[model samples]
Target: MSKLTQLFKKAQSNYDNYLKRDNVDGLEETIKAFEKISQSELNATLKKATLTELQNCNEVLFLIAKSYTAYAFAKQKELSYTDAVDSLTKANQCYQDITNYIAKIPPFSLPLDLGRQNTEAEFYKHKMKFEQAKMEQFFIKHKMTGAYDAEKAYEALQNIATAYSTFQRVLEKSYKYISYKIDFGINDELTNSIKDELSEARTLLAQAKNKKSKRRADETPTSKKNDNGNTQKKRRLRQRVIIEEESEQIESLSSINHSKEEEDTYEIPASEQEKRQATSESLPTAMELSQSQPVPLQGLDLLSTLAMSFFAPPQNVSSPLPRMSSTLENSITAQPQLENTNVFWNQNSTHIKDSQECNRLLNEWSLIYFNSLSTPVSEKDNQALTLERLGHALLLAAARLQKESQFFGQQKINPALRIAVQLLSRSAELSTKHFNPELTMKELSAQYAPLLKAFANPGRQLYNLEYLQHLRRQVYKESLLINTREASVTDIVTASFKALANTCFGKDYEIVRDTCFEALLSATYALSKNNHI
Candidate 1:
């Protein structure tokens, strides 16, 4: 081969080698070498070459841009924020040049490879914008409270919002081309990431606005005391101003939700809204109640109240009672009231044990993890980790139930088991829906299998296993049919209950039915407590 051809071939081999390495420092050194070559022999060769030669030069630029973008991502993963931002800026400029160069070539004359390069360039351009926005967000987060500048923070947030908007627009425009060329769903990832960033930016903007409003309100003049001081009048005026400020704060929060509602109205279809409403209605009222209340009601007290409401007969008799009948009625009522009051007092005297506190903490963390899954930017790895932790929580809860079963009978263990199953099944369904490997689903299922066996009858283990597999298959199929749209927690819980009802339980079928009903009630209560619905 000629010296010129040999040089090009060596450069291509080196580029391919650098692309495979994971070390950012090595990649940086390779980039420097390429730049030196590009400035000397490559520049001279490019100046004298034809259209075909210019296309080859553009290919070289494409490789360089890709390397720079990869290095930027590595730096980001390392949390070297400033260096990552600088790398991304340079990468973006390189991609922009590639985009402009390809646009100048006639459509009829443009090679297929050039079209692919152009799509890649557009992808990196938007990708870099997203990275830059993230860097700004990181900077804002690390700023010290004492040194924080409200104006600077607001400006950073605004820039991030703008970046998200522009990145979204670019992705939407180029998605089809990129999808065809890349043979993967770039559009979905870009859309979800940008949507999350935009939501965060808007939230920060609202907070900033609220802070500014509060400051202004605090600075407003209050009435001064006169020489013949009417202190009462001044106090009343101050109270009225405080009330007005509180009302304004409420109005601001309502306005934010109102705007979100309007946006949701356009995006959410009628069918989806109906599904959501049905799920919300089915969720337990206790969950909503708990969200409002400072402390959760004791499990025993809640169960007692539910039992009384469900089992108490109506008393419609209004006849005047004989002395003996009245005395008997008073004695019966007083006895249960006295017993219940004494039980409540006794229960109050005992402190919560370490095990119970640990259990409570586990449940709280599991709920938080579940809530985090709702965020658009949540990753598959994070989701898997959360699910694994939930599995551990389930095991801990099962152990507690097993201990309780020794004292309270198997029937008493039913409610806790049902909740654990619902949580496990939902996590499994999510793992599948998000395209997690079958191994992840299998590992989660394996973790919960022992608990499932502990709850199921010996003769019904096969049936329970079949039902679980079927539920997972159905969830996966439905997710695929719906393009992997997320199912609500209510829907997941309801489906799990339905599965439990349908599964064969041998001689314990009646117990299973009771368990399902209790689970439904408890789920509704939990949902209500959290105001999740």
Candidate 2:
């Protein structure tokens, strides 16, 4: 082999070695060393070189260009636009120099190869792409002043959208693309992540545009959350804002049957949910629901910020109860989105056990998370899953309201009571089809009976006589489903009276507390004709 081929062989070895580097520091060092082979670095030598030397310079530039591409791809993983821009710029410079000093290159034998696109046209295509990535990175670097940028956020999103659309095409075309994946494994996941972020950014930006005239911009919570070392609280709250699905849900409850009117009315007030199967454009916002009037689009700036957190890496949720030590989290006046819960929420006022405070903090997060949905939960959507998840948040709020509800001074009606019942009842409904564990069924039955008992009153508009009668029938059916297989007459009677709590007490449905006693007696009789109590 000629000396020229031997030098090229060594250059090829250096190229493969440099491309093998993964870390930022190692890649940087490789980039620096390989940069010596870049056009400008070789310009002085090239001007005085022989034909063989010029050919060698061309090969060296080719090797360096590929190394630069590898370095750029590695830096892109760090999500640092400055680094991406810097590395890709070096790469494009090398490729540009290769075409400038056009020559008949020797057979390609480099271990590290980008496969196709060896032509001048291909080089220019990739260089343009590198430029596109730089522009996109700039847009990301300047992402609208967090969610507070509000209306101003539209411009940043617009820039990101343009660049995102172009680069998406660039990534899919090159299967061997280094930037697509770190180790060149699956690229779809990362690509989809970019798509998802762009989609959410667009959605938020569109909403911002529509409300720009009416909605005032605010600052981001990123600083406030970091204040007073309340970063952990911020994380717990951030997780809730996601568009919740079954896999990501809390525990669920078994539900009973209800009338069509009840079904229409059965919604966790202020809980916003979007239909799982609905299209992006066609999906309705939860605010459109007559019952789910979440904080308006004006507060969506916060939603815009919170929405971005969903794209973040999976984080460990503080086990069970979560504490809110930060003033930003505890301030009710600051969070205008939630209903004033001074009656049920006591930890906010008085010093309490850490557990109680944590419960309240979780309550706050739940309200905020549901409110953040901004979109409508589809009627076709199975609300059972959402209600089950919500029930977990409402218990503390529910228990407090149920207690203070007996006293005259704090007779102030709290929405938590109704909302809690709505969640529990909806999740418990037998008609409400869900795949959640059947284990929580008995627990739901126990909780649902009392909540309905507390909520039942003659004059309340929501629980009118007609609805109570329907509910009484539902109770009778639920009891039959629960207690018919009794071993003894005493067991049957004991279970019957226990089931009576579920029936509305003030009125009679079938002459004797909805004839529940008679129905149980008849059921026990049918089980054994000779046994009568």
lDDT of each: 0.43, 0.36
lDDT of 1 by residue, 1-533 (tens): 22233333333334334333344555565456555543346545655555555555555565455556556555554544444455555555555665665666667777654565565555555466566666656545554233455544554565566556654544444344432222223535557877887887777766655555566456544433243443456877767756766776676676567546534532211110000011122122213333332222222223223222322232332221110000101101111111001122223321123223333444555455466455543454444444345334444544454554443244423433443433554355445353222234445555456555454434323433333332232222211111111433333333333332333233233343333334334544575577654
Candidate number with greatest lDDT: 1
Please give the RMSD of candidate 1 to the true structure. 29.3
Per-candidate TM-scores read: 0.37, 0.28
Q: Write the per-residue lDDT of candidate 2 for residues 1-533, one digit (tens) a residue.
A: 22222333344434433423233344344445544343443665655555544544544455444555555554454444434444545555555554444323333432111111134223333334424434443344345434444434444444445444544543454333342232222245546755775575466555545454344222111212223443457675555443232322321111112223334432212222211111122112112233332322212222233334322332432212100000101100111121112233333322123224333333444344444455744432334434444443443444454454343215422333333333444354322343211223435544454444443333333322123222322222211212222122223223322322232122221122223223333433443443321
Candidate 1 structure lDDT: 0.43
**Root-mean-square deviation per candidate:** 29.3, 32.7
At residue 169, candidate 1 shows an lDDT of 49
After superposition, the stretches of candidate 2 with alpha carbons farther than 4 Å from their true spots are: 1-25, 35-41, 44-59, 72-83, 103-124, 127-153, 167-533
